[model samples]
Target: MITCQDILELQLDGVELIAGEEGLDHPVTWTYMVQTRPFAEHMNQGNFALCVIDYVRYDFEEAQRAMEELYELGISGFAVSVMEDREWIPQKMIDRANELALPLFYIRWEGASFVDIAQSVGKIILEHEIQNKRTGDYLYNLLFGYDINDRYIEKISSQFGINFTNPCRVGIIVADRRYGINLEQDEHIYEYYANYLN
Candidate 1:
């Protein structure tokens, strides 16, 4: 019986609450996001646990049984994530998600077809995920204010080891709708760009 509040806040435009129950709490096999690595801060791998216990119950046996059932049902993080985005990911299905630690995803588009609904939904989710990560990283670096170019200092290059042969600056480049999103000043972004150039 995960309540609406239990669903974590997201940057997405909207996520439909297709008939959620208040009293029918299920396991914690729900993956709120699709991008796992970028969102290690939020939906970290296996950080959220599954449980049937109420607000007061705290027994290990019950948890063990529930987890066993969930695992046997074929619920992984990735799988559970895909289920949660669907309008109707059942309790039993949730239990399965707990077992597998699957992330929430849309069903209309799951295959390789770029035109499918799953692909469309995936694009939106990925964009939101990347944006949130980029903003967080940028803000963190801005507050810390460390010099990233120093790390790349070499004998001949300017601060960031340009190597002279192919002299140029570097910055992370992410391709968006016919455009490239360049976060050049941030350390992480520069690191990505530097590594990519090398």
Candidate 2:
């Protein structure tokens, strides 16, 4: 579970104070100031971001670009340092992450409150985005199966959103992994196919 102290430590432990060293120790409410900035007034609390790729190419400059853009747009997101070489993750990257101060959502704690809070916000935003994008194209493919309806191939759409498109036949994927841990990328298939299996 995420404790207040855990948050303080994860953030403080990874950061390197550059210019705004004060921001690190600053109250979480100072996030409000970031939210109100000209570029990001539209952003609000409980907003979350997820960034995925071949963590190999993850770079400090890339992190900076993404953070600056999101800050302007008023969103809160944290990047996972999935890389091994500690040297690759530079002070600027740490500084940038600290400035933006997005939550680290990749790790799991049995009952971390702060992680749960961030996830709740992120899930809502993603769900809304998916709802807006489901222009009947998804349901059609979902029922008919994408391979059978190949001619009707559309831009690969999202199930849980965030651009993970999967084509489901009449099969449900059952995993031994824990609940939320295994739910990524293939839920719609389970929605229909699970009934057949269960």
Candidate 3:
């Protein structure tokens, strides 16, 4: 789970958290740039929203409303870059963010770039996904490999932090024709269930 806290840890230039400290652990699935009105429609759950205050033309009240909508949409976090006149995010907006436990970030426009922040976050998410795939492959090998041995089990256990020393059980679901409903006839349905179970 690549999270808001993980993004902050990157310490990107001119980026800092201004509110919603308690929501730092919110998982971020992707990044979104909010340039149009009704931005919630363009966003999805676990998206980290990036916006330029001037570009959005949002006043304090409007910004607060947008934040509430984003929170309702399950946005992971919000980052706003302000123009020189504003200098900082409104205190009322900060208070509302704290109350909602929605991570709010401020990016100084002088030296920071939204592209750079988005790219860094994207890289972290991709790397985490790749690592998960590798772990899954290792587990698959451990379950079906022909030359499995005590040494191999121990190595895999240690490498993946699996406590194989304890009792464990594996459950398999076999899909077949039942009551005239043939699962094999529609592989998509079977795959959907397999992914859901996984």
Q: What TM-score does each of the candidates earn?
A: 0.24, 0.29, 0.79
The window of 10 residues in a row where model 1 has the poorest summed lDDT is 75-84
Structural RMSD, model 3: 6.4
* Model 3: lDDT to the true structure: 0.78
Tens digit per residue, CA lDDT, model 2, 18-128? 333333332121122122223343343223333332344445565556556764554434433334323344566666555555433332222233344454433543453
Q: Estimate, for each residue in 1-198, the C-alpha lDDT of model 1 and write its tens digit.
A: 221233323222333222223311322323333222223333322222222222234233333343344334432322221222333445664454334434332222232221232334335445544654555455456448667454333442332223445655645455233323433224333433332332
Clashes of 2: 5
Q: After superposing candidate 1 on the true structure, give the runs of residues whose Cα lies further than 4 Å from its correct spot.
A: 1-18, 21-115, 146-198
Query: Model 3, range 17-124, lDDT digits (tens) per residue?
Result: 999999999878789887566765566677899877773476656666777887888889998887663657878889988998889999987857989998999899
Q: Candidate 3 versus the native: TM-score?
A: 0.79
The local distance difference test score of each candidate is 0.34, 0.39, 0.78
